[model samples]
Target: MRESILKRVAVSRNVLTMLVALWLMLTMNLPFWRSVWQGVGGMSNDSPLFLLSLPLFVWIWLYVLLSLLAWGRLTKPVLGGLVLVSAGASYFMNCYGIVIDYNMLTNMLQTDVAEATELLNGRLLLWLLLLGVLPALLISRMPTRPLTWRRELAGKLGSMAVLLGVFAVLVMSQYQPYASLIRNHREVRLMLVPSNVVGAVHGYLKRELAAPAVLEVVGADAHRISAVSTQHRPRVTLLVVGETARAANFSLNGYARPTNPELAKRDVINYPQASSCGTATAVSVPCMFQDLGRADYKDSMAGNREGMLDVLQRAGVDVLWRDNNSGCKGACDRVPNEDVSHLNLAQFCADGECHDEALLHNLQAYLDGLTRDTVVVLHMKGSHGPAYYKRYPAAFERFTPVCKEVQLDRCDTASIVNAYDNSLLYTDHVLAATIDLLRSNAARLDTAMLYMSDHGESLGEHGMYLHGVPYAMAPSEQTHVPMVLWFSDGMQRSSGISADCLRQQAGQPVSQDNLFHSVIGLMGVRTSVYQPQLDIFRGCMPATVAQQVERSELRVD
Candidate 1:
């Protein structure tokens, strides 16, 4: 009997081990496995200098383990219970005000679907199948181990203590490596985990998590512009926001494609070297348009009395926001805003759904066919998202061999770029069309169209696919964006902007912040609060006294 028992015990151990191995193998064949592997490697690479930070990693893992152990006691099935809880929490956060876009999901997955598929097609699947089958078979043959209530109780108490300890440390930790931990917290509100923990982790590797260099500014009275501009009437300016537009990808900026064919011919002043404030719309949009600089964005939002929109409105300009984005944040609160997302405006085109055109369709109607000296803001859903092909119509699909879908990594780099370029091509057409619309009323209107992208995107460079990394650590492909301004003929003549001179300064480095002053100046509005030193129009002053505006850097987290 003793000999038989020994053999049975040995068999049981072997069988359980085999079962675990098999499950692991099966998981490896799935996309989720690839995501885990890739994410671990990517996170590790981001902080290679701190690769040996064992103590830190151990602390985190231990904390998680302890929490799981405690939960196990309270719940019969603790491990599964914890995972379910986490998933529910994530869903709740997304369902609420916190936006969980594709970037967040993709980043978490690590390995893209393409890589996972490729691995499945190779030897990975075979090994996983063997492991998955062997483990279950062995586990089935083994006898169940009886559970001791006393021992389970002890484990639960011990785990709880450990979990609490870790929580204390996290709260005490200042200058944490990842701001994502904090940023994400805003959305998820996990008891301890921050929404931006991902970004915070990357911050340990790169110092780009701060604000952009351009907005490193402090308090300024709104009435400061009277000294610079003579005109006293309140000047109205409209800021046209472009989404996912890359400078190098636009034809106006010399992209090989004819993306901006119309804008290029219209003599719009394109700023070639303009960099974005952040990599994603969530980070960049708020930061760029916010009153505070990147470094102190949170503080600025809390402490500063007003944002760009607020400041302009305070100066008596009619600030109107027309958006085609999924939703508008508080950025448009001070002004009247219209949500154009629900409008069905694609009458001429059938292939592409209503996007940027949605915001434009009712513009004339919104204006009541009567021109108002109003500052109208048009936020375009231009080139937005994983499905590039879906953003544009077939007519604008001029660039062939394009990646119509978001599984960009599966396609060759050139083809993926071609698809993106085609989207840009569509963007160019919309912009050109907008210009023409404005020009048609130029005789009675002092209209100006200023186009600036929230951030740039990475096609497949450096083994990365999309945007949303901290800007400083991000590739130049993600930072450099295109900015072009279409000044109505009347405004141009009023500002005394020579056609030859304006063209000469086309390639200059002008930060988005400069628009704050230039717009007010061009409108001949004499606010006492505007800064002349940071204005680009100052650069265009008489060449004798013309001074180059200082290039400011933005901190991105």
Candidate 2:
């Protein structure tokens, strides 16, 4: 009986392997193969995460190939069921990748994957193909054995229970705090799974989960401001929201570049002393746009606040948002938002995927047709790191010896800096082009552009590769960012502003908190909350002595 059971177990293993192979051949999509290929070659010409997990990539393909041929000898029904289940699981994972627009195959193109290639002569794609052979060999050598009905029944029951449990946990964990790791780190699913699964269970049991709250406008309202406006037609204010731009590296703020050459040429207001309220888009974006400053972001449900969009819309300003970043995270849910990511010129080289330039294409179109006083928000995928090489075109490869690998720490600081600078170079082009557009339109109406980043990044500084660190200990490079306001001649006249005075005050400290009210104030809106005392337009007369000091400290130059 013991010998018979041993033979039967061996047969089961071979059958399982064969089934997985057949299923992959049938269910794996073209994108999957393309990703596998890109993963091995350090080419982000397509996806993002390909290089980060190159080693494990081949193993997945190998598992599939080997499971198909020799494994078919196992009892037909049981093997067929397992194949179907595994196929579904793998397909689901791939779909999740698409939802987040993260492709593991190209993840390392910006940092260390290419450098490592020189040392290992091994391609992740090639290795993955080789790995597939191992399972094929295993199944071919195993002897076929008779199946036991009772054993088969037990296995099916166990698999069903596990699948149901996984599904239930995923649903229950959605609104809870512990599962934030899953929501935020979906790209690193394999590494994150076991712990996330454990966290999910705990998250399900925790009953105190808080539902997201709707914020209310209070204290300072912009509605009355527009109704009682002073001497001007409202300004056409365009706030360009930047993603993942760090202050330490910007040449305009003194990082050693001609990156800000264009902005410096114009009579722009450079708020070199500005800081982001949070470290990640998930936190900082909503916090910055809403009435809640960094201090009050945690309990955002008090309903004592309003977002920048709400305030502008309330004042009867025509508001529109063009997003090139990952979906708006509900920040622009209340406004007219357009996904112009596909129009990005870079997409031609980016394998049809979009980036920052996509937002710029339709921008002039949107500006040209607006009949009313308008406020447009442009969100850019600016300097979002870990894959900087893929963000720009080869023409901007001026900073060479740039790291093309994703493991940023493995490369020298100079190489990492080079890659980042290249991305910044492209940003410079986008900004210059945008300025030119606004300048041309300013002749017809008052126009201004305000650009601010969500948060900064850490590139191997103290051994961190990305942003999202807690705020209190975040490095200056991660919080201090380049903030600038570019005003047209018409805007200056309408707002009754002098370029020389604004430039003199440009280096002063300004928090994004002032932005919500400043927009309304600049547009000549007269809400009770529109505090000119906090407005940069007020020039040197800050609301409080402490705010004045804070602004002064920010002006290091």
Candidate 3:
């Protein structure tokens, strides 16, 4: 009995090793194989030799990867983890045409539990079970192989040398073709499994673990101007930061659909030529509030500096950030911030998620308590997708047969657009409600509202289903965002600017760069850091009034 048991144990261990090797060599490379096959199929009248060389190159690459993974006692566990992660990454890339890069991994790290849970679906579960869980189970059940330390060390060294040799020969044989292919089709390299995942994780770790620089305080000389009478009502400016709202879909920007009926009714100034600072909220949210423009913007530098909100607070203006989507991406770290996503309001929230309207709940009480000049920022969960249909209530679903699945590929293109348009409609309603709220408070405060989205979305355009592509390579559908402004009569008089003047400036090219200086100019804050050239309000204010304010700098003497 003992002899039989030993033989059975040896057989199971060998079987497990073979299974792991097959998974590493084939299962993890499924996406790469498919991409290669598709590329070859699209080739028109290509040489037979070139086609034959491609598969040979891929085989050598896989052999190197498999050899490197097949050493040491803990090899099974490490290979198992890689297999699972590769499977998950492959599914997302194949289904969504998304590249797993450092920015994407960073976005994943920043995702909240609620946002992460939305990605869970029956199809994902099925794939995980087939490709991940089964392999992991086999690995766990396999008995450990007993080997001497010397033998294991020697085996690892031998495998490393073999892989290096194979890689060197492959590079030498087809250096020119390989270089040209990688240079022209860079995205194809990003589709390679295990390498992309490992590189992305390494890059993310390097960024997160790097030593942070000293926080540079901007607008230290900031002080409110005294040109106006002391009895003038304090300003109440509401900065509505929208999510994933593309300008191409807004009727105010010449879309065929009337997506902005409510804002249209109001005499709002819609900037049709507006653009976003970045293509993802992870980058754009912080960039929008930073003093640096897009050309000089660096994510690491932005994280170590005081933003526009800090400058407003330093100037004795009250600043509040109420978030309905994910948190403020550290932009609100130094200010008073609220997360209203967990509120149990049945009218606005369901299944642990809430519409943008939830941010408006109890907002009046919060505003009434503030006596100083206030800058209130409401971060709305506007049109954030693959679950666009979940963003609004049933009443707002005017478009029929909307996509209800988080996996957008499963739905038809029309259904996807219908669902996205419905989300935009909801966003319109939310913005209109905010305008009404500001109008209601016009009697007591000089009220104004500014709305702009963090970034745009891509609904099945060019095989792309969502945003977060690198900005240089991103499409206009992911960069051109909607920006609208509404000013009450009280606000117009207090700021010494007219709606007509703002309308004229609306046609000029503007971006998130204008936001920092424009807000400070509107609030009448005098500081050396304020650049009049970048201020959109500078062109809109009366020439004499603008000259008087420009000369009325608060001297510290």
Off by over 4 Å in 3: 1-25, 28-41, 45-50, 55-71, 140-150, 211-214, 228-231, 301-303, 555-557
Can you write out model 1's per-residue Cα lDDT over 1-557, one digit (the tens) per residue? 96578565643222232233233323322322233335345455565533334234334443444243433233323323333333332332321112233343333334334222322322333433344334334444445333476654465455556655755555445224434433532322211222223233344324333424444322233432322233322223456888887787886677766778878787788888887766666556656665334554542232223456666555445568887664444466556898766555556333323567666775766554443245777877777645677667778777778775544556787877877887787788888888877776665555678888878877777656666654445677777888888777666554555545666877777665565566655543333456676456655655532221122121111
lDDT of 3: 0.80
The parts of candidate 2 lying over 4 Å away from their true place are 1-208, 212-221, 224-234, 299-306, 344-349, 528-533, 540-557
Angstrom error at residue 157, model 2: 29
Candidate numbers sorted by lDDT from highest down: 3, 2, 1
Instruction: State the TM-score for model 3.
Output: 0.90
Clashes of each: 46, 30, 0
RMSD (Å) per prediction: 10.8, 13.0, 3.2
Candidate 1, which segments miss by more than 4 Å at Cα?
Answer: 1-78, 81-237, 299-305, 346-353, 365-372, 496-502, 524-529, 541-557
Every candidate's lDDT: 0.54, 0.58, 0.80
Please give the lDDT score at residue 53 for candidate 2.
Answer: 35
lDDT score, residue 257, model 1?
64
